[model samples]
Target chain A: MNRLGLGGWAILVLAAIFFITPLVMTATFSFWEGGDRYGFDSYRILLHSPKLFESAWLSIQLSLASVLALLVLLVPAMIFMNLYAPRLRPVFEFMATLPFVVPAIALVAGLSALFTGPEWLIGTPFYLVVPYFFLGLPYAYRAIDVGLKSIDLDTLTEAGQSLGASLGQIIRLVVLPSLRSAMLGSALLTLAVVFGEFTFANVLLFHTYAVYINEIGQHDPTEAAALSVASFLLTWAAMLGVLVLGGGRRPAVGGR
Target chain B: MRSPLAVFFIVLFLAVNVLFMLAPTAMLAIQAVFDDDGAFTLEYFQALAQYQYASSFENSLILSLLSATVGVIAGGLIAFAVLKDDAPRWLRSVVTSFSAVAANFAGVPLAFSFIATLGTLGLLTKLLKTWGIDIYAAGFSLYSIGGLTLVYSYFQIPLMVIIFFPALEALRPSWREAAENLGASTWQYWRLVGLPVLAPSLLAAWILLFGSAFSAYGTAYALTSGNIALVTTEISAVLSGNVVSEPQIGAALSVGMIVVMVLVLLASNLLSARAARWSVKS
Candidate 1:
């Protein structure tokens, strides 16, 4: 309830306008009827396009595939590292973060060349999925690593072992449940990155949703705007869902 | 009790994941040193020198530096207002949430929005024309490099704000109160106390912003259509259209970008470590 002077209020208003202006403009342009009238024809056209649905479905599939792959790969590795190789944690963390420093387009360009020529993996969906894996790795690893740092993995494992549980059973039953909120956060982030990724999909000519944006960008600006709006909404919703699910959870047992 | 098969599967998965991550970058770096004649040479680098690539590299560096500087300063002000001060609750929450969402909202949609707001047929353009002023004729188009920087700042500001918020929050209010009790002016407190404490995070944030701006291809490519020569867009254009047809030069450009980004990241890491030490000592 702190009060602000007129100038401070003006600055706040200006900042808000600056942040919202682009999104507002995109929405307005999506519905502009080439003159004064506004209509829902642009959205209708987008909905009617068969390619849009196919690409949207493909995008969902790819994003889910990447997230699932990350979870399967990262969770056990994280559990092992937390329990056995905490000293090497930083090395893995550094390696996972390299992709973020590299430009997405540059990474895709390098990756596409490696796969398309002499390597010959471009013909498969696996190559496209690989970069998404890299995209998801840093965030997933960081989230899980932070979660691991907060909990007593050794004690948890010992407790499970005393119960006559196998290592796999311990990980599945003990470690994962404690790390659910962190895992959910990582999965949601990975999903967001994979879903919105445009550079690789466009370069590789993958018919993902991002490519749908690029395609509609060429022939129909309005439809492209509609798709962009859809992307914004989806990304916002996923982020909000993550915050709601992950934000208020109690700290893992034995956490600092 | 015996599961060599499971062990073998685990080893194979690890090997394949490493290969997936490393092979592409390694292939490009190796190719960058080889030439069209199948001999190792600096010919690609030479070609880069002769082509517009050199200037493009310079342009990218300058633009990124400028954007990062401006972004950090703006972000610092906003973060300070929200975190360190007793700002209005509603305004603080709005900025915090908006900063998170806006930081991720970039690329083509960002470019398109800027164009719609500032283009010839844009809202401001129409408003200006009605007042007997032509913004375009006055040398104000949003497609140039400078205009692109302005557009980039929209997201970069939010990014810096979010990244620095934690660092700002970690500053103890007692230090500020100590300075105030000694009759120190605000500038004196900031100069002697705040700047040293915040220097590492600010530098780290700047380096991250620089790396982002340098490698940003989508917004620049969409806005300027590779017409404006950027290191990333140039490499993408060559690879996409077979313009170079020599993958070595394309790889060389990628290598160049990777090298620059790594150097910045390394420096930022060092700076952050130093900052951590400083914070502990203080």
Candidate 2:
């Protein structure tokens, strides 16, 4: 029987306090109704809000659209950049990842300024996905790049070309399936990012899930807490599901 | 040997980045330097030195530096415990995935969750009070810089673990073995061997965390209720303002943020580039 060291126990306890406690507290406050009782009133209240359902549904739809657009933008560009224009790889990486330094607030400020003349854009949720696409790009590019690097893009391209395979066959049959984990990983990441995103949706006056949640918070803190827990847990579950389904190496974020 | 079609797609990708990322930032720079009539003027940049702008910038710097420092220390310790110490398998994977998740986790849900834990009527605050401590009476408000720092560190710690652990892994076990053969203590080994190897990446990671927290809006927005004047909230206030008065002022603030981030990111990039040379241990 190995006894855990005092330091090990301390780290675990600290994790409980720092990471686990806030979650437990939020979940509890979510369930804690007034008049000395615990009930599902908070969640029930959230459920009854047509605004909540409507915005959440819209957020899901926009997020799906954004992920599709991201794949369309990233995959071909990445494979072509890797296989053909290898010299431009660093420039490509820099530009794609540069937005990480720009805060969501800053991007929202810029987009609103850029879209000023197009007062029509400010009216709909359509333009909101553009910024969300930028938000997810850095991570998505990294995920796809990791996948490309794992399978030799050069060797695969050469092999496909020798067999008289078209670029479409190479991409659809050879490349994407080999990079399946990363594509799925990127899509899952986009889903998590879009639902949790606030600044872009809020400033643009769109009613995404996060914007709706903040509005709910203004009127009712308890219900907001309940919804926050649910949304957070849902994201985690999706991430866990992706890893499980991938059944291989999960796309690492910062690892080389 | 490459086809023209391949070249077009690469150009197209660059255009997307330019249109979405660089152009917006350029708009910020232009707005910051130009007046209402579109002629060049430095008024907005100059306004950055005033009390409203200067103070918020200062608050952001102070908060980011302190939070990054504390987060690096705490996170480094946890990463060491999990990686070097042979902790349980379950614990390692949990910390790894949680760090990845929490690293991306930001904005309102994060801020409100902290409020649920430590706000005036918060659970932790209540717990502290039961133990004969009144945080509010002692001039501790979760709406202040101190409280914001506490919340910022929560994500920062996990982020450090995620980004910093790779370098830790890169420190070949042979280095430790060699250090021990030279009669070095654990502290000596880290100081003489590990510290030098990691210093650059550590600094880079710290800068990344600082930039992240400095420009962060949602957590500070919800926790401080926009009363506090961090740069993120300052910019957010103007951009989200109902009236279209002086939109360039918000652009000026964002330009300030971009400048700081650009400098820090450049320095971080140089440092990491050097550090990568060190990690080519194979």
Top-scoring candidate (DockQ): 2
Interface RMSD of each: 3.1, 2.4
Candidate 1 deviant stretches above 4 angstroms: A1-7, A117-121, B1-14, B278-282
As a whole number from 0 to 100, the lDDT of residue A206 in candidate 1 is: 79
B214-235, model 2: which lDDT tens digit per residue? 8777778777766678888888
User: Which regions of candidate 2 are displaced past 4 Å?
Assistant: A1-4, A117-122, A245-256, B1-8, B242-245
Error of 2 at A251 (Å): 11
Interface RMSD of 1: 3.1
lDDT of 1 by residue, B1-32 (tens): 32453344444435645676667778788888
Q: What is the per-residue lDDT of model 1 for residues A29-128, given as tens digits with 9 covering 90 to 100?
A: 8897778889999998877889988887888888898988888777766666556656756757766777776677667766765665544566765567
CAPRI band of model 1? Answer: acceptable
Best by TM-score: 2
